[model samples]
Target: MPSKNGTKDSMLEVFVYAAQDYGYSIDITLNVHGSLVTGKIVGEQEYFQRLSENFKDDSSETAEKIKDELLKASEDAKKSDNNNVEFIHLKNAQVYVGDTQPTPSENHFLWRGKIDDVNGFFLGRIKQKN
Candidate 1:
């Protein structure tokens, strides 16, 4: 089912949360508000874990605070249900603003966005050029 305003696809929610419990992932391309975002759907635990690591090298207080928040959210999400889950997380995600593909960056990053914002989606990832 496609996502609607303020509501996410229930099937997608189950898939994402399952990834949290198990370590399986599926490549997906989401039509998000007229934009295409391609990546592997990841669990909240993995999402927060990666985000926390990204800030580990920074010793700034703000970074620490962010890390703390991520930790809290991670723990909270572990107990989340499909009805309560708010966001979708992706790994190695790349964004295409319109019909044309943008220049692919060498770096891939973790991305998190509101699940309700996704209008449609498909079951494959875009292959990047070398």
Candidate 2:
């Protein structure tokens, strides 16, 4: 989440699945237009569930809402083709609404940052070194 002055910057949350049939358990931010907001994949399934549950009313409602949000976010992301993945230099990284790094872990190589001030979350695949 992008923050200014040490506050939780408002973000729209969405889910990611390890496989299409597997449950979508990753929590990420989304743009109002329905794109997943960018950030490093630093959290786990429990964290994602907690975050998703926070935004939903009930388990059933949560699933429905998740699907809706995912569809909308996917379409929005597709429409804005320019919003796809990119290489962000970790040392040169910054949040959209703030100048500070989002307290990432060393396990994550790609620092997730917003594009176009749209506020969707993305996972930059770890760059492989040959």
lDDT of each: 0.80, 0.34
Q: lDDT by residue for model 1 over 9-110, one digit each (tens)?
A: 877776666677676799998888988889998988789988898888899999999999998878887776544667889999998886565435667788
TM-score of 2: 0.23
- CA RMSD of all predictions: 3.2, 13.9
Best candidate according to TM-score? 1
Q: Who wins the lDDT comparison?
A: 1
lDDT of 1: 0.80
lDDT of 1 at 88: 83
Off by over 4 Å in 1: 1-6, 79-83, 99-104
